[model samples]
Target chain A: MHIPDGYLGPTTCGIFYVAMLPLWVTAAKIVKKTLRAKQVPMLAIGAAFSFVIMMFNVPIPGGTTGHAVGGALVGILLGPWAGCIAITVALVVQALLFGDGGITAIGANCFNMAFVLPFAGYYIYKAISYNASIDAKRRVIAAGIAGYLALNLAAGLTGFEFGIQPFLHKTASGQALYCPYGLNVALPAMLGEHLLVFGWVEAIVTALVIKYLQKQSPEFLEEGRKN
Target chain B: MSKGNNFIEYSIAGALSFLKESIFADEYATKEGFLQSLDPRIKVITFLLFISAILFTKSITISLCLYAICLALAYFSNVNMWFFLKRTWIFIPIFSLFIAIPAIFNIFTPGEVLFTLKLLGLKLIITQQGLFTAVLFVTRVIASVSFAVLLSITTKHFALLKVLRIFGIPQVFVMTLGMCYRYIYLFLEVVENTYLAIKSRVGTRLHYKKGQQIIAWNISSLWHRSYYLNEAVYNAMLSRGYTGEPALLNDFRVKSKDWVWLFFTTVFFVILLYLNRK
Candidate 1:
């Protein structure tokens, strides 16, 4: 759930950007250390791919359409820093060029899907990979599950920011910062939608991406690949 | 194997190239520039304060004032006006629709209609207050979106991550984000190269139904590879003596200019608040 510009107060919006600054620096250093000249073109293409992939709608169980951020997919293949940068780039372009999300809301959205999800997904994948001694098949399954679950966890955090955050200003006893009912309503809806409708699509996409990289570009698995 | 080794893959490749250069490169450059200047700790705390203020404000006047301040910051940052406009447009429909849909319920429930109309099975009453509330909602959304974009454009993603770590946000979270940034684009390149190949082979009649399936299959494989990649990265980190907590060299220096800028902006917002209250 991308928090639109006005949905959050100015303070919350501004603070998150501030909070995000150090991460941005670390990201830059990581890129500087890691990115090769040959990798640049690939990264650009990946950025474009992000745009194209998000545009295509996948069908859910009911009638609604959904798409994957594919954060983990990218993180798993290229490394999480590149994945974060690529997705943030994609999201910024989408917001600026397409207007799907607001310019002001870009930080929040990036924080949610791009910054949070990919990183979380990467670690989860790593933790699982570390513990297991599975072959390719099982590894792929673990990656897929991790990717899908990570996205939902990211969504949950977004809900917490948008849905539960305002309530924090309210007394702990609940004196109505905005509307308790509204917060109550939004929390479940966000979690439900992500879990049921979008989560499965994400899982499927995550699974497919894991499989592709395993078969085509196994170097991507250098860290987690069990000999 | 990946396809499209050369630039001559697709007829429309030029368009994609242009978009890639204009949108992607410029954004990375911009992100790099803004994030370099501020103290991550200060930035993070300031941002938190701003978010709280924005969420706390319900008054249209206050919201507008906050929005104006955001615009002023954007202008100062030398961010292009058109760039800002273009980004904000995407969310307008969704934002408006989200607010407007709920407002429909507010119409009939208000009892007294400032304006009434006949509609399908329900009254489309627009009370002055309801209308005002609607406008405020939209305004708030716009304000928040604009500010966020400005922040992202100005700041680098790495800086933000470091700030998160420094601020006692969990290490796992920071590590995850770091890894995500490391690899996202490599995955994209794979997809892009594959698509280019697919496009060349499939030709102009290539709106195949199974394209999605192909993409999904590729993504599945990508995930498998990514896990191993993560492990390799971890080893690299370990080899480099990466302890649980990363060491920072204290690169940020708050110049007099930053202090001046921060002070002026804070004062400006305060003035706006005063005016709104008056």
Candidate 2:
């Protein structure tokens, strides 16, 4: 989910920015080394694709519809580094253009959605689907499970970020200056929703997309150095 | 003939309406207004300073003052007041309220009990300090989101990208951002057409399972097509003498009015910071 500004104190936001700086540098290096000049457009298109994907309404059970974040799907198609950059670009655009997420919290938001979600999902998918044939049903299951788990992981981290604010930042009289909930409250609130609803939607979306690609355009998956 | 089918159709309609509204919102950014008239770089820097000032201060009075300033700015910028308030308050307050609700309960945040009640053999107390903290949290979040919404609704998206470039964002990052902005509209069109084509063929209702499968297939095909499209786009750029870096035709010039605005904003921020320390 998008964490708006003022939810986390400046200290937490600052630490995340510092933590993300090196990862961003490394991602840029990887993108430069692996992708050729012609493939640069893929990065841009991928980011745009991630942005537009959220607009799509996916049919779920019980006659309702929802959307996926598409971070894991990007990671599965293009490698995690590319996914990171693409999703990060999309997040930046959302903040600056639409004000969906906080500008100050961009670093923390990207750390969750772009870095944590994609990389964790990608690796989890790889680990589960390893040794299975590319067309195996197990691979689809792997994608779904990866999506489910990666989202929860990001959710848990977000909870930690919000939960710690009360403990870490407080005034002289012990009133919370930022988010007021402790870990006990924040973690469960975030984790419950994702684990119950959004996680399943993300899982199904990732699995279905991967399955379609496997049937129609398997080459895209194999050629892109997704591992 | 099924309720599920109607729900799906309604959701698709809702999605399209939301897409149209977003596009409509973009039209406001191009209109001549106070914020629209400022160089985007100056607007970006000044708004960012305002956000930082809001974040740095713990005083609720200062936060509300900043929120009022954002409202004043929006008023001067020719933005619709109702639209601005609705955009800022509708989502952020409700979302923050959900986050802040638990803070008001005594179990999570300890303080003097404002109200105590026994329900189902359980003691529930709303704490005075918790209520204060929750309100403070909501106020700060509201103030922060107000500035963000003001900045976005007044500044054109392309101008925002250019401001990012001016801030020394990496060329690759800026390039990707520029291209992404350019292509989002095209991709949205593709998505709309794909859905419309499916609707035309299937009429009002189709088997739910089949509909999902078709949507998945469409997404995959879109991805595949995008690969080829990227190559074509790159070639087109090359043909037009495009280099690696994007070159914009409009040069940014900050006039004396921008400096005056900047000075006043800086003075306000300094005063807020001083008052916050007190």
Best by lDDT, which number? 2
* RMSD in angstroms between candidate 2 and the native structure over all alpha carbons: 2.3
- Identify the leading candidate in terms of TM-score: 2
Which residue segments of model 2 deviate by more than 4 Å?
B1-3, B6-11, B115-124, B204-211
Clashing pairs in 2: none
Please give each candidate's TM-score.
0.59, 0.94
* Model 1 lDDT per residue over B1-278, tens place: 22222222331353355346345434643643343366655655555445445655656677777778777766665666776666654546354646444443442224235666778877666665455545566666666666555555566556655666566654544454445444544555655566666666765432222444555764544444444454565566667777645555446667776676567656755665565444
Candidate 1 ranges with C-alpha deviation above 4 Å = A5-65, A69-227, B1-44, B92-94, B101-112, B119-122, B170-176, B204-209, B231-245, B264-278
User: For model 1, what is the error of residue B181's alpha carbon versus the real structure, in angstroms, after optimal superposition?
Assistant: 2.0
Candidate 1, residues A1-227: lDDT per residue as tens digits? 55555555445666777766776668756765776533433444445455555643443333334667777766665567766766776775555433356455667788887778878777778777775543467677767787778888888877766665435433333222232225565667678988876777777777766666566655556732321
Q: Number of clashing residue pairs in every model?
A: 119, 0
Question: Which window of ten consecutive residues has the lowest lDDT sum in model 2 chain B?
Answer: B1-10
